[model samples]
Target chain A: MYVILVYDIGEKRVGKMLKHCRKYLNWIQNSVFEGEITEVKLKEMVGEAKRIMREDEDSLIIFKSRDERWLDKQVIGQERMSTDHFL
Target chain B: MYVILVYDIGEKRVGKMLKHCRKYLNWIQNSVFEGEITEVKLKEMVGEAKRIMREDEDSLIIFKSRDERWLDKQVIGQERMSTDHFL
Candidate 1:
């Protein structure tokens, strides 16, 4: 299965979050990640993200798509040029 | 039907995009918007969005779910606290 992970955080510790997410998935866009992951891995990572994020001040949304073909994506321009900006 | 609208852009004309999107959907988060729209309305709005955006420097993604019940969304924290930030 393919999963798209996007996160919203209250703190400015996006560096840590980005690093943590890179271990399991590709850094596709700002706070957005996607890759093939098993159901078991999805559950495990979701649990880990929940644990790592602030319950009241952070949110992690995982859009699980059974197939990537159903999603059409297009990338253009210098959208994410600054790594120093928010992740 | 329910539609999820997300966009990536190179220029800094987010204020116009935000205003345009707000006219048709609810601004849920930065560069993210969602609302219940009919199939006809979805198509119309998508065409408008495409025409309104820069073809080479902007990209728009629409996730259409016939039923919103299928999506599991959890929102927490002060993630989108700033309006001056990127849309």
Candidate 2:
């Protein structure tokens, strides 16, 4: 499935979320991450987020597109993929 | 319904998308916006995007959640709502 993850949280924890997400998906934009992930991995991501989240102050949204072929990913700004490899 | 819109485009046109998007939705984060919108308004927004989009070079995605009540909005960063009125 195609998963789009967007989050809003406090400062320090945001870093943790980013690190946690990078393990499972590609970081597409500030506080937003998206890519194809398996059901197993998706649950793992949710579990990790749940483990790290500060429920009262943090918010996380997962947009699940069962079929990506029908998913319209539109961009009106720089393509994060164009950037040089961080590694 | 709840809508999540994300985009990626070239430099010059990116501004246009941002301006166009702001007309119908609140700018939540860079290149991402979400909120409740009526079907009528949703079409209007989509029409506007389709009209302004440079089909070859730009991309726009809209994620629709049938029921906002069931939508899970999780954030691991700052809340855009608390940033004080921009106007």
Candidate 3:
């Protein structure tokens, strides 16, 4: 499944946030991260990422199908952002 | 980024498990499921999927990067299941 993690973060700290997520999530592919990803595991990743962030930092992790209907609608409604930013 | 959801389920009910995940997660394209997947949203999906299953059914949603080092090592140790099952 195509899991797109959209983290809204500061331009200065986005790099650090991505790196932390990559390490905690063990991400090595485009935007993909993996482990024994149960609900608990997922929560742990988010918590760890949150802990690593500054007090004002925030992030969003979006998971969806490549052909997700709602996402397609979102792309139509919102300005389409390049996937390369995270990739 | 490839997020693979490995659902451990009954042989009889695997099809339904996949379908439910597809609907709730909005999966399309090679095991990809997309939604505004927050920790809460992920929990909701898991709960919904669990509720839909029968007493004999079980499932595990394993999300990982396609190049997850741990998963690659797992593939070396464990049997590599075909991706087609979820795709």
Candidate 4:
């Protein structure tokens, strides 16, 4: 599936979360990552994310689609990071 | 259409952006919003966003789908905001 993951992590653990997410997806902007992965990989990534997050304060949300073609994306103003290489 | 909008705005202008987005979509997390809206409303929102953003430093991204059913959302850890009312 193709996914866009956005996270709001406590200041202390955010860097670790960023590093871990980078291993599985494209870092598109501040605290935002997206890319394609299998169901197994997605499950594995979520497990790791749970470890880095604080249940009381940190949160991660994933928006999933069966494929990229099912979604349309538009960017306005400056793009801090690009996921274009994946194309 | 259903759209998921995420933004990276300069600290000074972020509050305004947040307020503006809330008028059109459900706040799902920090800097993240999702909900259904007309093509015209989306365009209007984008236009207002451009006015508040500095083209060199801020960026707004919108991920659109034909309908909410076409996408799946998963939340991990604490959800900063609830978007259940719309559902």
Give the TM-score of chain A, superposed on the true chain A, for all candidates in the order listed: 0.79, 0.87, 0.44, 0.89
Model 1, range B1-87, lDDT digits (tens) per residue?
666667765466656767777777776666767678887887777676666778676766666666666555545443453243454
Better model by DockQ, 1 or 3?
A: 1
Q: What is the Cα-based lDDT of residue A34 in candidate 3?
A: 36
Q: Write the per-residue lDDT of candidate 1 for residues A15-79, one digit (tens) a residue.
A: 67777777677665666676788888877776667667776767566666566665445443334
Q: Write the per-residue lDDT of candidate 2 for residues B1-87, one digit (tens) a residue.
A: 777887765687777878888878877765678778898998888888878778776767677766555444554434555233342
Residue B83, model 1, lDDT: 43
Residue runs of model 3 more than 4 Å from their true location after superposition: A1-87, B1-3, B26-36, B54-57, B64-87
Q: Candidate 3: deviation at residue B61, Å?
A: 3.3
**Cα lDDT tens digits for candidate 4, A21-51:** 9889988778788899999999999998998
Per-residue lDDT tens digits for candidate 3, residues A1-87, read 233443445577667767766644444332334322444555676676666655443434445343222121111011212232444
Q: Write the per-residue lDDT of candidate 4 for residues B23-63, one digit (tens) a residue.
A: 99989888889999999999899999899889788878899
Kindly provide the TM-score obtained by chain B of candidate 3 when compared with the true chain B.
0.45
2 against 3, candidate with superior TM-score: 2
Whole-model Cα lDDT of every candidate shown, in order: 0.64, 0.71, 0.44, 0.87
Listed in order, the DockQ scores are 0.31, 0.23, 0.02, 0.83
**Residue B50 lDDT, candidate 3, scale 0-100:** 67
After aligning candidate 2 to the native by TM-score, how far in Å is the CA of A74 from where it should be?
1.3
What is the Cα root-mean-square deviation between model 2 and the actual structure?
Answer: 5.5
